[model samples]
Every structure is written in C-alpha cells, then in structure tokens.
Target: MTKAELVFIPFPGIGHLVSTVDVAKLLVDRDERLSITFLIMKAGVDSKVDRFIDSVSAACKCIRFIDLPKDEHDPNQPILLSFIESQKPHVKEEVSKLVSHSELSHDSPRLAGIVVDMFCTSMIDVAKEFGVPSYLFFTSGAAFLGLEFYIQALHDEQKVDPTEFKDSDAELVMPWLTNPLPAKLLPSFLLHKEWMPVFLGQTRRFRETKGIIVNTFEELESHAVSSFFKGNTPPVYPVGPILNLNRDGDHNPRSDRSNKYKDIIQWLDDQPQSSVVYLCFGSAGSFDMDQVKEIACALEQSGHRFLWSLRQPPPRDKMEPPTDYVNFQEVLPEGFLDRTIEIGKVIGWAPQVDVLAHPSVGGFVSHCGWNSILESIWFGVPVAAWPLHGDEQFNAFQIIIELELGVEIKMDYRKELFF
Candidate 1:
C-alpha cells in the first residue's frame, strides 16, 4: 500500500514558515504512512530562511522543500497578501507539475491533499483543479480564527463595514466572544484603512477551504475551537503546542551556528538559575533612539542579568538590501554599554529557543508574535508582553488579561513609562 503525500504551502515569513514546518514534522511523526512536501515561497530576503529550511531538511527524511518562482509586487501592500497574489500563477503551475509527476510514478506516495497557509487562501483554486482537498494552516491560536470568521460573517450577512472598526470606540460584540472586545485590543489591520480591505478579503476566502488546522491545543482554547464550528465553517483541528525540536542535538546546524556565540552561553552559565531576563522582539520589532535609551536606563536600574537581541530598523528604501551591521554606540544611551557591561549583554540576533530553554533564563520580553509566545510557554518562561503589530495587541490581551500567564507593557512607544 502506498503512503499518503501532503504538500504544505506556507507564507514566506519566518514565523509562519517555522509553524508550518513543525506541523509538517508533527503530521509525519504521528502517521508513519505520511510524507510531506514543504513548498517554501522564497521571501524578498532569503538567506536566513534558506539556511533554516536546509538545516531542517537535512535532519528530516520525510519532508522536502521546493522553491516556488518569485515575482515583484508593491512594497506598500501587506507583505503576506502581496506574496499570495503574486505567486498565484507560479503556485498553480508548480502544483500541477507535482501532482502530474506523482501520478506518473507508481512508486511515488499518493497525493493526499494540499495544506495552505491562512494567508494563501486563494490556493484552494489549485486544489480544486487537481481534485484534492485543501486545508488552511492557521498559525495563530483558534480564538483569532474565530474572530476573523465572525468579522467576515458580519460583513457578508449584515453588510457591516469592517472599516467601521477604524473610527468606532464601541466594544466589538460578536456572538462567539464571551466578553465584548475593546476597540484598542483589535488587530491593527482592522483599525487602518490601508490594511482593512486586504485583511477582510483574505478572511472572506477562508470559508471556501475544506478545513483549518490551528496551532493551538484543544484544552488550551476550548471555547475558541468550539466557536469555529458555526453553520458552514469547515472542520477545525486544534493540533498544536507544536514546537521546534530541542536545540541540544550535537549534529543540529542551528546549534552549530550558536558556537559563534559561545560567550553568550558562557554568560548564561555564570548567572544563577532562572535569574536572567531575555528581551527580543520579532524580526520587525525595533526601537527608535529614544526608546533604546529608556530601555538601557531601565535595565541598568533593575540590575538583573540580561540578554537582549536588538535589531536596527529596516532600510528606508524597501528595495535596498539590508546592512549587515549596526553601530550600537549610535543608538544606545550615552555610556550605556560601559555601565551595563557587567549586567546586560546586547547582541544583534539570537537563537531565541535556545536562550529561552536555558536554565538561567526566567522571563521573556516579547513582541507577542504567536510563534514566540508558544516558544516562551513551551519553555515555561513567563512573558512581559510588548506587542508591536498585527494581532499582537489581541495576543497581549489573551496572555496578560484572559489567561493570566503574562504581563502587558503598553504598546505605544512614546508612552515608554514602564520598564
């Protein structure tokens, strides 16, 4: 009997790509008769993503990576939506070729289905053409999915303008939500004209898919999971808490890269158990000069052992390539480095999972990216939620207010009153 083969198409961002990769790993591990083909859409910047994918492929025999053809799109548009729209022709052509080739080979694993990232809802057309089921991989928790569905439903059934969320100060009352959600905690997209149409457009396409596999466990979000089953919505799977494998494997390439930062590990080793706080925002999270200075002052005042993964802002020209280095002296407080040299160590990029997994690390200051949130929870590290964009405000609410697992620092950088 032939084993089942599933194709996974994930949005190009690291967070989405990592969650989809873990889902692929989980699917294969749970069912011995399954194989996964991970179709990685190349990002505008590809080096780090390429390295990460290559490392995972080297370790897993059941998973394979296929690079989809890339196209140029408007930089101002939402990156996820732009990528999905631009890749339509390329994705269709590639999926057709993959399906055809598999049918021709008697020894090949049977094509079971296509699993697409939530952003790539339009890919369901390709699945329809091939007569295969398409499932959406919702990288966030089930609650976000429920909210998106409710918003989309409201727009279709009641002619409610999702854009009204922008100017309205009223509490968002949805049937699925147990309590009214304040306007401030809504996703940034819903509150901005530039992003609202694109977000709502994607949400509308979601109902057309055959099923959705969310990255959250049933027990953790039972209410949210149950809410997704209203009327004609597809089957929902709460198959998560799925995380990256432990980084301690000697043969692991991610850890091999960590060897370059032996000093950082040594610093963690010197601290008392669970004594250090790890501060890292996601790829897009970075502070201005004023914010950086304030953080430096706070770190110095606290006198806690710290590891901060700091990132400089993106280039002003979207088309311009990013620089490899940033001058820490220019952005940080005056004499900040010298003063906190004994207490805090700041670096550009960090192996976050490894840092959080460390015995000496106790808490995380995060941008509330869903992947980072899950990683923090997996390591049993408490969070100081500092959400930057998208659904981060909603996630901060989930963590700090609803769940009582973390604390919230205000999202406004100008109001940087909290340490």
Candidate 2:
C-alpha cells in the first residue's frame, strides 16, 4: 500500500492559515504514510507564516511548503468575498503543476486530496478538476457557520436586504443555532448586495466538497455541530482543540523572542491560579492613542495584572493614530507602567497561545479572532471580548454571549477619541 499526498489550501490570513497548518500537522503526525503540502498565497507570505512553516517543516520530514502566484483577477483583493472567483483558475493551474512536477511515485505514494479553508471555497473546483477529494475546513464555530448559511437563505427569500440587515436591530433566531443572533453579528460581506453572486457561489462550493472539518470539538458545541451536519449530506469531522496539540518545548520557533518578555510569564507565575487576566488584541487589531489610553486606564483602574502588546500605530502617511497623541507609550495614563509594574507586564508582543495555556492565566481580553477564541476555549480560559472590525464582532458574540463562555465589555461602538 502507498502513502497519500495531501495538500492544504489556507485562507489568506493569520488566523485561518494558523488553524489549517495545525490540522495539517496533526494529520501528518497521526499517519506516517501521509505527506502534507501547504499552499500559501504569494502576497500572504509574511514573516509569521514563513517562520511557522519553517518550524513545521523542520519538525516533520514529509511536510512541504509552496507559494502560489498572485491571482491576476482576484475578486477579493480590496474586499473580502463570499467566494474567490478570480483566484480559482490560477490556483488550479498551480496545483496541477506542483503535482505533475513532483517526483513522488504512484506505486510509492499517490495524490490524496486538498484541504481548504471555508472562505477559500474556490479551491473546491480546483480539487474536482484535478480529480482529488477536497475537504472544507470551517475556520469558525459551527454556530457562526449555521448563521451565515441561514442569512443566505433570508437573502434568497427577499425577507431582508443584506446591506440593510447590517445596521438593523433585527434579531436573527435560527433553529440550527443555540441562541438568537443580532443582525450586527454577521460577516460584513453579507451587507453588500454586490457580494450576493460570490456568496451564493461560495455556498455552492461548500455543498460540493467531499467533507467538512470544523475547528471545534464535539464536547464544546454538540448541539450546534449536530444541527449543522444533520442538515448537510457531507461528513462533518469535529477534530479540534487542535491548537493544544503542540507541546511547549524547545520546538517553539519564537523561543528567542520569548526571553525578551520573561517578565510576563514571571508575573503570571506569581499570580494565583485563575486570578490574573491575559490581554492581547491580535496582530491586525490596532488602537489610536485615546483608545489605547482609555484601555490602559481601564486596566489600571481595574487593578488587574495585564500583559498588553502595544505596536507603533499605522504610519502617519497611512492611517494616523491621533494628532494630540504622537507616541503610544506617551498616552498611557501618566506613570501607568510604573504604577502597575507590580501587576502588569506590557510588551510589544507575547507568546499568545503559550500565555493563554499557562496555569495562571485566568481570563483573556481579546479582539475575538476565531483562532484566538478557539485557543481560549481549548485552554478553558474565559474571555472579556472587545471586538473591533470585520468578523471579530461576530466571533465575539458567538463565543462570549451566545456560548456562555465569556463576557462582552459594554462600550460605545461609534465613539472615536484623541489622546
């Protein structure tokens, strides 16, 4: 019997790629006969993804990394889409070329299939074209997937305008979901009538896939997962807490940078179990000086020990933070760091998953990225959800309020402030 060659197509983002890569690693680890290849987008290749790929490849002999060219006609270039039409043909061509040129023998091993993220459903067509089975990897919870699918139905029934539903106060109560979700708790792409075509196309692509793999375990979302798969024909696999699969050892790629923030772990180590809070807003989320100051004040006022990642705000030529506030650390309530030094550990970036998994991490203040939510839940850490933009608000709602796993911080959503 020959081994199987599996290729994974990850969505072009940190959260999606990270989750998919973990799944690929798990599959390779379980089956020695499996060879895995991660196909990343050209523009999507960055320091973080490259570092992770290097680590995985170095750790596993059968895993490989490949980059696909920038699609000439990417429909989702400026805006995220329900389906990525333009990238399909280019992806298909690249996959075919890679398989054909590889030296693996048919007698020794054979092309197995492609595993694709839910958002990149366009890859389904490519897999079909290549005559390889493809599985849909939903990089979100079953509840959100069900909500998105139901919204598509509502769009078809003309019960509501997709654009109007975004800001509307209408409560969406789906039979397949655990609770009623607010209209605002949906993906922003659903608000664009222009996205209707792509949305439908993407849904169709999902229905056509061989199977669906979700990044949630059955223990966490039994009802939602059961409801979702009961209505669909494809096999649904709930193989998760996948983020916890990797052990904290010397294998960590970021160990060198880990020392730069040893004070963080030391502080957490000092705290009582489930007493301290871990704060991280993820790589893409940002705050202006005023917002940063407010958050700093809040944390200081709460007198909670926190570890915050403060990055240089978007460049002046690009999106300026605030006119009154020139520096990020400047806006912190005066002597903020000194006052909280006993309790707080402020660094530009910290080892996120490692921090969350620590025994002392009581709760998480997060931007509500799906991967972050899953990681928090996997480690059984509750969250204080503060969503910014994109699908973050939706993810926050699903995990915090809907799932009874965390709390949402009440704040004025539209207010913008200067330091």
lDDT of every model, 2 decimals: 0.77, 0.69
lDDT of 2 at 309: 67
- TM-scores for every predicted model: 0.91, 0.85
Candidate 1, residues 324-361: lDDT per residue as tens digits? Answer: 24688888888988988888888876777778888999
Best by lDDT: 1
**Which ten-residue region of model 1 has the weakest summed lDDT?**
410-419
lDDT of 2 by residue, 1-419 (tens): 47778878887666577778778778878888888877776443346556666666777778788776664443434334412455666677767776775545455456789888887886787888888898999887776667666766776666666678757888788865667777765665666566555665576677788888888887877887788656754677888866734633322424673465566666677888887788777756667768888888888989876777676554433212212223545757788878898878776655787788789888898878777888887789998888765567777777766678988884114222111
Which 10-residue window in model 2 sums to the lowest lDDT?
410-419
What's the CA error at residue 268 for candidate 2, in Å? 2.2
Candidate 2 residue-wise lDDT at 55: 69
What shift in Å separates residue 174 of candidate 1 from its native position after superposition? 3.4
Give me the candidate number with maximum TM-score.
1
